[model samples]
Target: MELEEIRVAVLRIEGTNCEDETVKAFRSLGVYAEAVHLKQFYSDMIKDEEQRSLFDFHCIVFPGGFSAGDYVRAGAIFSARVKSVLKRDLEEFIREGYPVLGICNGFQVLAELGALPGFDEDKPLADKPEMALGINESNRFECRPTFLRHENDGKCVFTKKIEKGKIVMFPVAHAEGRVIFPRGREEDYLERLKENDQIVFRYVDERGNYAGYPWNPNGSIYNIAGICNVKGNVFGLMPHPERVFWRYQHPNWLENPESPGDGRAVFESVIEYLRKF
Candidate 1:
């Protein structure tokens, strides 16, 4: 497939504030991209022309937002709706090696949907969630630029363009971003994630050493900022890559105004992978 031939769907619902940015990020690469309301994909009330299928696009993106008001839990309602309406289609989509991206709250949804740390490819979603993105350790919405060190050893298709050990900055804004594992199985889960090369990014200080608190932002276990499925097609992270598609979007834009922002590589990596698919 060619870059221009690829289609990206940025899934959105009420409270999803980042769809425009996510769409723009893909369009910047000259690929066909648009924000599609979740209802448009399956709601019977939607006009026939507006209705869409999961396979219509090569990539599906769940942009950042406080879906369904986040009353029960971050992404709980949204993921439930997806499971009820689009579970089978989504499973087939992932099975075919198409890309699925979840940013910020979207990441929470993927975890809730059992798409992240997705162990069984034959069964894309688990009967129950194995992990969660809990509230930040600070107990406040942390919205600031943070550094991330790329750790994937070529397993994440969305991050292949980024060099290993390279540090990039992307802003995060969420109250519940901490990645938590159940008791007694933290080690087991961490080991499986590591052994499978599912771990993609880790929060780090300016010097690139793993750090805690402000550097780790949400204080996720292992300082994990992002992860991918075992197949490496599905990816989720707690940062807003679309917001930093351009160098000027960076807080230190003046320091390097001539180059693309750090987040661009993420979008580029997806294009690169699709070009060969």
Candidate 2:
């Protein structure tokens, strides 16, 4: 449980505002988390550089917020910057079997960058930015505490320790939280995901009282709140798990610090996964 056991890099860039919470979340698990600004990589002026390679970190996080102001599309600018500057190192990291997580706006970034499935092999079809995260079916930005049910087929490194059908609470805040896959190819993609066990997390009724609409918050395809790559190394999701790292951060659980009901499991899962590497 040493603080220096796990190494995590929390990327910070313009419009990327969730670094502190992400850092704190990992720090609580006694992991070494560093907040690295995107400017550090996008810069060409620093001659004697000591920046660590993406491979050096066991987990790399693209936390929430409207990266690049969500202009020209969410995560477009920052994604392009990453593709241009960190492409080689990032791809190497992926090939090396490390965990990469993109949360909220970060999820949008991964999709736009063709880092997720359906778009991983090539660019998405015309008019689509690899994957589409469009306006919520509700047409409004919903910010509420939510729950996600773990899928059994999901064996991703990030969610490996979470039991099947286990429901965890986290909050999602986004206007374009609805996930869109190719039309008429939904089942095919899902089957492929199932065969590969790629589906990681799904929105569910936290109270276990309802099964649709408000319980889902956003109308994501297949109730998907998050997913992983075929290799189970890269993960991208819409909810802000880092925001609920502590018991007080939870919407409930006021009198129980050891309830084990907050979002700490997400970080601990990463810690556990890193232990093997």
lDDT of 2 by residue, 33-100 (tens): 98887766556654446455676577889989988889998888878888888877777777777788
lDDT of 2 at 141: 90
What's the CA error at residue 163 for candidate 1, in Å?
A: 0.7
Most TM-score-accurate candidate: 1
Model 1 accuracy (lDDT, Cα): 0.93
Give lDDT: candidate 1, residue 74: 94
Model 2: ten consecutive residues of lowest lDDT? 118-127
> Residues 217-245, candidate 1, lDDT per residue (tens digit)?
99899999999999999999998888889
